[model samples]
Target: MTLLHMSINAHDPQRVSEFLARILGGEALPFPPFPDCWIAFAGSDDGTAIEVYPLTHQLVAGVDQVECRVGGERAEPTFAHIALATPMPADEVITRAGDEGWPARTCNRGPFQCVEIWIEDRLLIEVLDPKMRADYRAGMTVRNWRAMFGMNTQ
Candidate 1:
């Protein structure tokens, strides 16, 4: 029932892959089966992974919007942003993100707090606090999860 991996469309897969590896402490490995993709495997040794794919690659079919219709409006998913539980402090993550030129902001959604970093100024990544990730893994509805950790300010 645990998440195994998540694939994201990246304008530059190789660069994004390296960026994720540096921030998330993962190995960016190329998939032999997919010539144009790489995977940034982070989290626990047996946890989840972040799959990086070229945005324009044939695989993605040019559909870049990762959105869903809600109340007749387009909106992002609750867990839309990739959440990474890090051993490093939240401040450290922000510092590194800044050094790498990624726009980052500290956010608190209800009981959960994280530093949301926009990779390449487009992709969303939430550097989570290790202390609170357990409660995050406890499984709440997407609405609750969004209300607690999503980026929707409205």
Candidate 2:
């Protein structure tokens, strides 16, 4: 199975979406389903995308629908993060994120290396350039993961 899209809360949805678009080498567009929401399309064959929502907005469960309401207070950093493959160089990714005033750095994740970019200094998005992506694919496998923890990889 492949991941198609994910939703994230941002202090500035529009700006975040635009920045994500640049990283993905795609475009940022308004999301019609919700007001002030934006989507960053990765322009890949799999149609990978990220939906940026306002930090105050919360998704509520309804009887048969999901309701979006603006009532959530500012939240602290979340442990959740996504790793995306990008065609851009690692240095360029770091440079772009730094230019946007976000803290970004290349980190060695043991099995792989990735650029950890903190969005709005609140959320984390791990970006993998071509070389990093290659290392990730090689190192991130079911067998490797299990073996790392001394689990039987049968």
Candidate 3:
């Protein structure tokens, strides 16, 4: 299965959405379902997207489904992160993130390399450019993962 979208909280949803859209070579638009929320569409065939919500927002179970609500709090340096594929160059990604006043650096993940961009100095988003995405796709295999973790391939 493939992941089409994921949600993240940002101190500035509009700015974050715009940054993400530039990275994905797409567009940022207001999320119709949720007020004050923005969505960054990757414009890819698979419909990859990222939903940006306010930092204080949270998703809770409603009567019939999940709903976004206020009153949630977050600590800096959350463990949750996403590795996104991008068509932009690695240097451009780093530069753009730096322009946003966010800390970004190239990270070597043994099998592949990605740029780690810290949003609002809190959330982490690993960005992989074309070359890096190719490396990721080549290295991130079930067999390779099992071998690295000393798990049985069978």
Off by over 4 Å in 2: 1-75
Which stretch of 10 consecutive residues in model 2 shows the poorest summed lDDT?
59-68
The digit string of per-residue lDDT tens for model 2 on 9-52 reads: 78799999999989988777766567788878774523466889
For residues 1-154, what per-residue lDDT tens digits would candidate 1 score against the true structure? 2343466756687888778877777556564335567667663434355667654433211133222222322223222346677778788889999999987777653445667777776666767766646545443223333454443543
- The clash numbers for all candidates, in the given order, read 0, 0, 0
Residue 134, model 2, lDDT: 75
Model 1, residue 141: distance off in Å is: 6.2
For model 3, residues 1-154, the per-residue Cα lDDT tens digits are 2343567888899999999988988777776556788878774523466779887775543343334566546644442457788889999999999999987888776678888787786666778888887777666544554465565555
TM-score of 1: 0.41
- Candidate 1 has its poorest 10 consecutive residues by lDDT at 59-68
lDDT of 3: 0.70
Per-prediction TM-score:
0.41, 0.53, 0.53
Order candidates by lDDT, high to low.
2, 3, 1
Angstrom error of the Cα, residue 125, model 1: value is 0.4
